[model samples]
Target: MPTSRRYGDACPIARALDVVGERWALLVVRELLLGPLRFADLRRALPGASSNMLTDRLRELETNGVLVRRRPAAPAAATGYELTDTGRRLEPVLDALGAFGSTLPATGAHLSATSVLLYLRGSGRPRAAGTYRLELDDRVFTVRSHDGRVVVVPGEPGTADASLRTDPVTFNALLADPDALPGLVAGGSAAATGAVDRLLAG
Candidate 1:
């Protein structure tokens, strides 16, 4: 950002925007909510972000204490980024933003795996106790729901109690209209149907 760029306002909202209002800044935060992600993983998630732009955003966020950069311990040795306490506090904010955005008409754009993951985390509810394997084309993720909250982990777990396989578009549609789940192509144990039903009822 240019040094001259400024909202020049005293409002808290303006101050917050001053920190994260820049393009791709908040999206970076959104991506890190689930867990630490390597730089390459981040690049894959936000393909529109050029390397320089992404680097600047990460630097700014780190300087602002919204995130931390670290090297994974032993065996891994890869650099990754994760949110700080202040940054994690934005989870609810992003969730609310997502709920509000969903009401808007679709732009007919294709969503990336990371975007879909954010949507699931933003909108998911723990209506059943089990692991749900979500197969989005070739990408897979596991949804573990319990205690009235849902946790989404990357990749399929050893085994899933239920699984939902669909493309991003279909999944987004399902999120908007749970009744439309019948349109989804499903495959799993009968118990999986029950688990998914409970989730959709939300």
Candidate 2:
């Protein structure tokens, strides 16, 4: 953010970008969309982003009111980062971006958990209808798809027809091309059980 202060364009979009246009800024917000995360978890989720860069982004986001430190129930517990109401408003923005990106040719780039989960929300219908829990890296989310619509929320599923475990990168690969699932499973690169086909298929 060496020159992140302002766009000075006065356009609404430019002003909005002025707040979140920095590299990894919107990504930080995306990671917190489902819930909160400690700095370490954020690092794990975004391995490509350097610690110093993330620190700067966090500080800038906080200053701009997009992020806030969570109040721990116990004083000794660690503080985590969660999005403010203004930050949550970016959900549709991210969703629209994901949908738009999907229409383009494959870039073979890595996909973040947030991006992959949003993909499911938009168009990934379950092979069989039911609730399922997804443990992606350091986070857990519940997904349910029916009538060609999918829904995902933070945390474990109360009861599920299936369960899954995998890092987001591998999950992205598996979903992008279902044909690779067998090799991925055999190679121990990805693992999903209990109606595996239902949870990961579109």
Candidate 3:
């Protein structure tokens, strides 16, 4: 449990939560874990969160040394938020939380854009030095590893080795268990217009 500033038994978990346990804080960190994103992008990625609340959370995160805001170099006038090295270490914690969350029954059964981004970050299969474009129905995803960092663009064009096409619910289910893909496709719950099976094989 978290302890007051007064001298008391202060557990590390509690201490850590003190900095990030506030509503929307962790989710904000999750948004930037994969890469830097503009404030507008983060706002779009996290729907339902008010602009004021988001600003508060971002400020708290910065004050706690978990994230940083900076302006992009030449040719770009936009500012973006990025995770600090200390914040990057929280990736494993977030991954474990995701695995655990997958086990619970989904109440809303809706996948937010942030959830999709996190899924892509977590489910991505590391490939050899190469790039591939993924197409799913009308949506396209371009994946590449540049300078040791994975980059995923939602809409881009190129040939692809595999593509998984499914609605958000089916995609979430498949992410929880790759074996569920076939049933989702065969049962008409999902439509795979490309090599979706191969993509989920691993």
Candidate 4:
């Protein structure tokens, strides 16, 4: 988008939309929510986007101070893109969008690992203090719930009060039907089921 591509309005919402109104802009932000991502990783997460379009969107976001590109730390390392503090503020916006979009019918879209992780993080709202470990296939994430909120970080915790391990399909099922957890849990850990229930409760 050109520097002049804007709504030419004074409203805050319009100004904000002017910066991120283009196609694939916000989706790019969504992909980078958890952490920085190399160009290849971003392409993998957004298979439909062309290389030229991706580059243009990245440039636009960078120019707007929404994200920054980083150089490789190692000789063989790939350059990556990470959100700026201004960009990180979009977390709640993405969460609200995801929650609202969930009401729509399924499109059979392929959910990438990051997409699943984002959904889990967005859906989580723990009422009490606890540590819950979630394993999605080979990926492991530690979710710490305290003060009526939750923080999900990658990797297993040293000591977790509860844990849930399952593939993406089963995990989605568990979210859709909390009552079906007992049958969905591979190990039938009640603690894990309870943890999932609390974290994903509507």
Give the winner by TM-score. 2
What total of clashing residue pairs does each candidate reach?
Answer: 0, 0, 0, 0
lDDT tens readout by residue for model 2, 64-149 = 99999987899888789999999999888987877787788987467667778877777644456788888887678998877777
Ten-residue segment with the worst summed lDDT in candidate 4? 184-193
lDDT of candidate 3 over 66-142, digit per residue (tens): 99998778666788899999898887888888878868986764464446646655655543434555433344566
Candidate 3: TM-score? 0.66
Candidate 1's C-alpha runs over 4 A off are 1-4, 73-77, 124-128, 135-140, 155-159, 164-170, 173-202
* lDDT for residue 135 in candidate 1, whole number 0-100: 71
| lDDT: the better of candidates 1 and 2 | 2
Worst 10 residues of 2 by lDDT: 119-128
Regions more than 4 Å wrong, model 4: 1-5, 124-129, 137-139, 162-169, 178-202
Candidates sorted by lDDT, best first: 2, 4, 1, 3
Could you tell me the lDDT of residue 1 within candidate 1? 57
Candidate 2 lDDT for residue 85: 94
- Give model 3's clash tally: 0
RMSD of 1: 4.4
Q: What is the lDDT of residue 7 in candidate 1?
A: 98
